[model samples]
Target: METPTRTPTAPPAFADVLVVGAGPAGSACAQLLARQGLRTVLVDQHDFPREKVCGDGLIPDSHAAFRRLGVYDEVAASAQPVQHVRCVGARGGHVDVPGTMSVLPRRQLDHILVRAAQQAGAELHTPLRFEAPLVEGERVVGARLQGPEGQPPVEVRASWVVLATGAVPQALTAAGLCDRRTPTGTAVRAYVRHAELAREITQLQVIWHGRLRGGYGWVFPGPDGVFNIGTGVIGSHSLEGGKGRRRGRNLREMFEDFCEVYPPAARLMREGEVLGPLKGAPLRCSLRGVSGEHWGRPGLLVAGDAAGTTYAFSGEGIGKAMESGMLAAEALLHARTQTPAQADAQVLQAYAAALRQLQPQFVLYERAGIVNDWPWLADLLIWRARKSPRILRRMAGVLDETQNPARLFTLSGVTKLLFE
Candidate 1:
């Protein structure tokens, strides 16, 4: 179904920048560019307040982007505070971490970012389908969009085009930045409402149980008497089954099984009424995807999932997505200073450099995905953390990014955890 649109408006003949998606990355990029006095047009296939498949959990990483966009207070006021995180191991061993996190449904979150972009002087267009980029030789001038219904195809031009089309690989693939079939994982979430469930819980739980040895399932308490329950698994692992059978579990089957077996999850979902259908989406992570040269082509740049900035292990993309957008904006601003022939390469090089600096943790997570495949190691880590308060605190700090992940791998660090 087409997302409902706001008041109808005509497309401009030209703009300084054309953003081809109104999600966090697109909205943040548009807002930042507009604030810098660039004429920006943001378009999306779905309208505001639309449902997006996600865990709805916002960790410390999302704080900077919200504040930068001037919507931190608004989001904070409406969020359900998550004071602690609990990870349940394979053998039921566990670690509980105390920290600050919250849940704000993407409906409210995306709306906030879109409105913020509008307020920042960017023209917002929704219910518009991005068909292709408007290309002249090697430079991207703007985009070609499909108008509502049979109205007509519309061509809008801009000096630079930004693709924030999210996890759908079509746009990126069409741009030749990614292979037609990029590796992807699946995630499914459903919302449930129950007063007792909300009243008794204010924490997030990630459980590694049963068939979910490699991936995990989560239960996140949402604001206003709701819960976001879900499971995510890499595509490669999703097909594991019983005995010698080759059949695999689907996302729906995984969700049902997860809720049926996990104690805390079962308890929360017991009497709660399901508020929405189980929705699923593909996650394009940093596992094996495109790079800077692929992302930054002449007069074009990609951000968010289209650029595969999501963390490899956790699949956390909101913070990284927004960061990429802001980085793109900064690069474009710098590009304005260079000659026409040098602008594309300059922005590309600058954005690549910035991403390298910002994503060392994610790089480690990519390598750590191998360990995640080994349930015994995961169980050991959780079991050890459950026995040591100091290690638990360290893990908590690592989650908040206050402590470096590299330190956790050091000889001294492992010794302290083992003996202290």
Candidate 2:
């Protein structure tokens, strides 16, 4: 993908709808809206084909969503297939979950999605920094933007504004539609090139230990001979007191230590060539009222990371982020046909209902995250899962989201694991 042509033409004064940030969420939302002839304008501070810090692993659900967007083929052209996921417990129990995933760097994935949005009739604006939302009496009606220096700032008015500005959430914060302090988690990743591992590694591997029970380290296949290696830990993980809590290193320090001490990961990494400096980012786990609200005041909607769509345990959010954007577009398209006085209320209500359906699962994942803080339990479960195909299927279900996460916490489930 080449750099998107930066527009030097004068900016439009208004649009039917304004989308902030051109990542997965923003681009997906704009594509749907514009395809419906909504005169959408999608803006981002960075140009296309740019680097984004991510795991670059798209789970099965992400493929499903991409197919819905008609870009799965394009993604597949540049992606590597992942056939399974392997989990290693600190107690030396290993369980492999069979599934399918795709690995595509965000630099390529984001560009493809943005191009799709433009093809669907959304106006693309690059290098346009979002300043704030255009609000009136607590209602967000549009957005204010600052272009390159030396040019005057521009105000683009619209009937509605959608904030998809990712984890940092500049648009959501500027509108004052949510919390002053966004709760967040952190993750760091590095690129490693191991010729043998690259050839033999057809699955995604995660290492879980008693020391860093709250978080896990991963090795996912990347293009060519590269492997995307990373570790993640939520801020609240440090506050949880459990058997796994032994007072060890910080996240970055843990990553360094993990590369040295964790045999499965360390062995492969030791034989690999380091490609780039480690990159890290704060993750917003869609904590309602803490990160930001999904349905805000009239004429405003927050999708993707800005709306806290990321799952808690695995931190795999690409699918959920795009899912939220698609839902928002559906609700907004419906609202557009309604009377002006009723549109905002109606859209908010519909979007809220859609979000409500996902709340239970999110809460369940949060519980799983807490449970993961206890490595002994994970060790037991993985060991049990290795013996029973039934348990193994259930465990794999949790990762792929095919089953309710609450099932893992049920009395029957625990009894079956221990004695069955």
Candidate 3:
């Protein structure tokens, strides 16, 4: 159900910035803005500590964001330290690439961000679904929210409206901001609680198998003897053959095949108890879907998955999502002193410029995502990585983003792997 366009009977609430969806992006944005003394309001359809489907792998980028946000110790306290990413290939050749990484369930990680935002003086409003953006003469002034039951519609007016909703296209579509209705990809994950499973999976494990045509599987060891195991395919029915290069099976078949194909997953399902039903979520990636104009409109800015910040090859979103949110916060803060129209112009230009700074990296990731279709490439890379210390170092560099993956996964690179 949708809230009507008519003005609300109650008095309108105001804030300096209003953020929708309290995921990592929204909460991170709100916290940074609030920390800078802006009257920020963060709203979400659900409450904190709710379930969120994710691989939950916090790589180096995530660590950098946590430190910049000044909550690394708080968030890392609940995380399980992971040293390497065990990349298993289709032909069984594998390598344990070293990195600074950890896995923390989204249930815990998101709550930490929300609490951090609140601690920074941002007002947290939950159980309020965002209906539409409140626009004043084509510039978004705030949002129209639909509260529970017959609690009456609430109009929140702000100088800026930030849409940080992850992957779900409904909010963007409702606000007439969606260019692509379907997500570029989809993923499913489930939590399993077993001491042996968690103990065995010390590294962030990922398997690339032939059975999974346009995707791969992962088994991340989370905190307190819990593991998050999942698979992500680049295409669904509607998204088939677009970036995936081929169509993939349904999420059910994908999960089943992943469990049956990977030894770790097979053991996880056979011995450990699945904590809950398998949860599925969409992934918007490669910076494709939304246009640059939509990324930052007058008085409106999008961050996280809503702005396609997730990496294509690795399926890592947490770090990039937080980065984009922080960037949006920086943009708004930089332009806070200008007049309404002038501020909107400056912020929009700043967001656009900021996204451009990150575009080259996303393009490289998309280029490397071709390995999903040809699992043999992973086998070759792993095989070479095992033989040469240089290759292994390059693999580790890719994890830390100190080296470009495009340089590691190309025809010339493959030739060097064979000859060197």
Candidate 4:
């Protein structure tokens, strides 16, 4: 792939929808919009095949989303299917959760999606640094971008601007569209190539151990003897003595400590080589709520991370991101048929309503504090289930999101936890 070069003269072109960020969210939105015969342009700060810091695991819902987007075959071809998940507790007790999932290196997965968007007729520009939103009256008209070569910045004017910028909501906040909040968690992860355990454990595993109070370690397997291992802690609990940066233990150190306790993992580490840097990214537990008031202001709409569609428990953002992206595209298409102000309101409302309706369970789960506010409860459940095969199976169903938590916890095997 060629790095986008800045020309002395800006390209004189316009698009119906300008998508910022070419990751899964932006690519998905761009693909859907372009397929609908809308002129779409997808922009990213990095070139194709660039590495993204992630666990690289795709859940069953993600697979379903891929199918909906007509890219399931492509994703399946590039990824290794992960059939089961194992959760290990701090006490060395572990529970195996059987489920259908897949693991793909982010580099390969991201490139495939970008290409898919391009094939769907979306114009893709990469290595283009996003400057700021171009505002016309009270609405966002488009965006300003500068290429890596230091040439004059180019302006992209569009009927709608979709912000799919992941994780960091800075761009949206900077434009006075969203308020920024401190991330509630931080994680560090790195890829390792180990041949031995790669042969022994073909299933994905999430191991929780260490002094880190509210976090767990994970080992997600990928193709070619590769695995992603990492640890994360709730930011609030990670702080030491209520002080400075040095007060908290870094996730890398916690992961190293975990490896010391797990003999099998230790053996793999001694034999394995790091494939990349110990990458870290913030995990936002709470985002400025996704509201229609700020979502669609004239010509701008937000989707994916920029729209706070991330799950609080597993930090699974990709599936929600793709869902939001597709919904945004549909909303934009709806908007095109109406007058400007009316169109904006209709598009924004449609996007927001679709999200709320599609994931009503998530909203309920969020309210119940399934992942965030109940770490100890989660740990106890994992520990108990590990000792009972039948209970483990029930736990697996819950983790798979196939059964509701209320139903899963009602099982006689799991109800023992209440008595205990």
Best by TM-score: 3
**Candidate 1 lDDT by residue in tens digits, 1-420:** 224447356678799999988888999999999999999999988767788888888888888789888999988988888888887766777677888788989988888888889889999887787888888998888888887797787888998999998887777776666753534577889899888878777788877765674567898898888899998875442334655433334778777778777876777667788896889887887623564344668888888888776776676788888888998999999888788788878888888888777667776666555434554455666767777777777778877877665444333444455665
As for candidate 3, its clashing pairs are none
Model 2 regions lying over 4 Å from their true place: 1-10, 236-249, 287-294, 409-416
Residue-level lDDT of model 4, residues 4-110, one tens digit each, is 32222332368888999888889899999999898888888887878888778898777877998788998998788888887665666666688878999878888
Per-residue lDDT of 362 in model 2: 86
Residue 154 displacement in candidate 4 (angstroms): 0.9
What is the full ranking by lDDT, best candidate first? 3, 2, 1, 4
TM-score of each: 0.91, 0.92, 0.94, 0.87
The per-model lDDT (C-alpha) reads 0.78, 0.79, 0.85, 0.72
Residue ranges of candidate 4 with Cα displaced over 4 Å: 1-12, 235-249, 285-296, 358-360, 363-379, 383-394, 406-420
Model 2, 73: alpha-carbon shift in Å? 1.0
Candidate 2, residues 125-210: lDDT per residue as tens digits?
Answer: 87888897887886777888988889888899989888888887566667776563444577889888888877777788877776
Off by over 4 Å in 1: 1-7, 235-249, 291-294, 404-420
> Residue 77 CA error for candidate 3 (Å)?
1.0
Q: Candidate 1's error at 372, in angstroms?
A: 3.8
RMSD (Å) per prediction:
3.7, 3.1, 4.5, 3.9
Q: After superposing candidate 3, which stretches have Cα over 4 Å from the reference?
A: 1-12, 237-248, 292-294
* Model 4 deviation from the true structure expressed as Cα RMSD, one decimal place: 3.9
